[model samples]
Target: MDHDHTLFHRDDVVALRHDLALSLRAAAHHGLGEGICNHFSVMLGGNSGLFLINPHGLHWAEVGPDDIVLVDERGERVAGAHGVERTAMFIHAAVHKLAGKTCVLHTHMPHATALTVTPSGKLNTKLSQNAMRFHRRVAFDADYNGLAFDETEGERIAAALQGADVAFLANHGVVVCGESLAAAYDDLYYLERACQLEVLARSMGGGLAEVSDQVAEATAAQFARDRDQSRLFFEALRRELPLP
Candidate 1:
């Protein structure tokens, strides 16, 4: 997995590293990341068979561009000062390879993980405008075998995605994927918000008001057309945070 560090210095690759690091910091800031567990990854440009991931042992709050580890599809460290976590390797590499996602974000954020443990085992997309944005874009994995200890487990999780951009892993966390980091991160943020609202609403003792499928689908499409907002939101994060 060792490679010339020179190749990692390409302008686009550097930018991706910065953006991924900033995203980790943002996730930490927003309480989307747990201790040193959840991982985020981005495929290296142009089908390079490599990706950047946060090194193990570093909290998301302190991750920086240089802390991002470059690894091959097999999860071997190609260039970095630290080692890759075992679950991160299996999960992220499989998602990038099997799901063909350019950006893969996995987190155990409180609200979303709370939904995963419920009987419904997935988000109720009809519950809120934020949830509506995820209508028809979510897949559910009802089986919770255990931790992803190997490649097959990772592949199973990827297969569960079933071409959807969001997946709620039974008894686990959630995975959010997108063609770009900004778009995926946007989904991650709002997804947690939606789930938080649902949890709060359920606590109020009244039946949840639901939106019709037709309305949810239309709302999703409307949100889809505002893709620029994702980019702008990420830009706003960069402006507000001390990322450099």
Candidate 2:
């Protein structure tokens, strides 16, 4: 929470914008994006109460430094473009109000969202090692009240996600947030991979042999103690982008 409270260097904004675009393109290439519908954001300028996201209507691959939209905590557009997506505003604005997390990434990635819509969409820790990484760490929002078009909806989502790094909205999709942009992207990537593995395993009709709660907990502990794992994963992915 409150990552910083000082003036953000101009170069900070420049790097934030560039890295954000790279992440968007990476998401697109990996088929983790919908038809310009998902949202990703990073806070801009320390203590400036400002954040940046791609403007509505731009495909993830098309997002660039100039196309990034700046918005206040209230979700009003302050820079880059005229309008912000209503649901994007609703969810992101509410989340950024909290501390600790800086970058928030929400997606309709098929693998993960497919699980969300199923009766057992919640990630089961016993499902796989990746699943174990989220053991007892996921917030499941069992209710889906249509689209998040207002602040009230945003507040609800934020409340459901409290104290957790990831939120799996039943019948909706997933939300991943992290203290840094790389961590956020890395988590999103792993989340989708975990879901894909689970779904495929289930498709084999083996009835999902999940690990015991004890083992799952141990795996989660191991993941939490993992130093720089997410950073390394994200950096490797970033190198494949047009530029860092």
Candidate 3:
């Protein structure tokens, strides 16, 4: 488990570090954090399989740019702190290595977690336009094997992603991956909105009103073709929570 020095080169290093810190702060602001748990990581570049992660046990608010650590795809901490979070190594490292996802963000946000504890633990896709966007995009990992502290568990969770960008972990929280930090952050925001709307709508005791399959498919397609707006979305959010 030796660290690779080549992975720590200066290319895009500052930007990645800033974005990682900004997202953690945003997570804290949006109430996506649960104490000092969960993790946000971004792959440095293609093929290198090197990435940066927030410090283990550092509350989201306290995770500044200098606090992020570097690790290789094999879950080895090549730079920064002596140890990274076990679950981060298991989950983020596995997905970035196997699935080639650039950004792997997991959060135990309230609404997202609520969906996992339900009987089906599925995202109610028919709830809203936000919900419809996840109609065919949401992946579910019904096997809640407690905390992921090893490579095997990480592999299982990555397999569950099944090429999908978002996953709802039953009895747990959620994982969302994207080709860029911006895409991942945008999806994370919309997903929380989708889950929150569904939970609130269902809790009213008035049963549920759902959109049709055709509309859902069409709407999801619209979201899929929304790649151009992802930057704008993340920029807007970052603006709302401007960092010094």
In candidate 3, how many Å is residue 232 off?
Answer: 1.3
Residue by residue across 64-140, what tens digits does model 2's lDDT show? 77677777787766666446787897888778785345888999888889889888767777888988888887888
Evaluated at residue 5, the lDDT of candidate 2 is 23
Full candidate order by TM-score, most accurate first:
1, 3, 2
Clash pairs (backbone) in predicted model 2: 1-99, 1-100, 126-211
> Best candidate per TM-score, number?
1
Top lDDT hit: 1
Candidate 3 regions off by >4 Å? Answer: 1-9
lDDT of each: 0.92, 0.81, 0.84
Clashing pairs in 1: none
CA RMSD (A), model 3: 1.8
Tens-place lDDT per residue, model 3, 1-244, is: 5545654556678678888888889889888889988889998865676789988878888777778888877767778754687888898888888877889999998998899999979788877899887887788888888789778877888899888888888888999998888888888888999889988988888978888999999999998898778898778867887766
lDDT, candidate 2, equals: 0.81
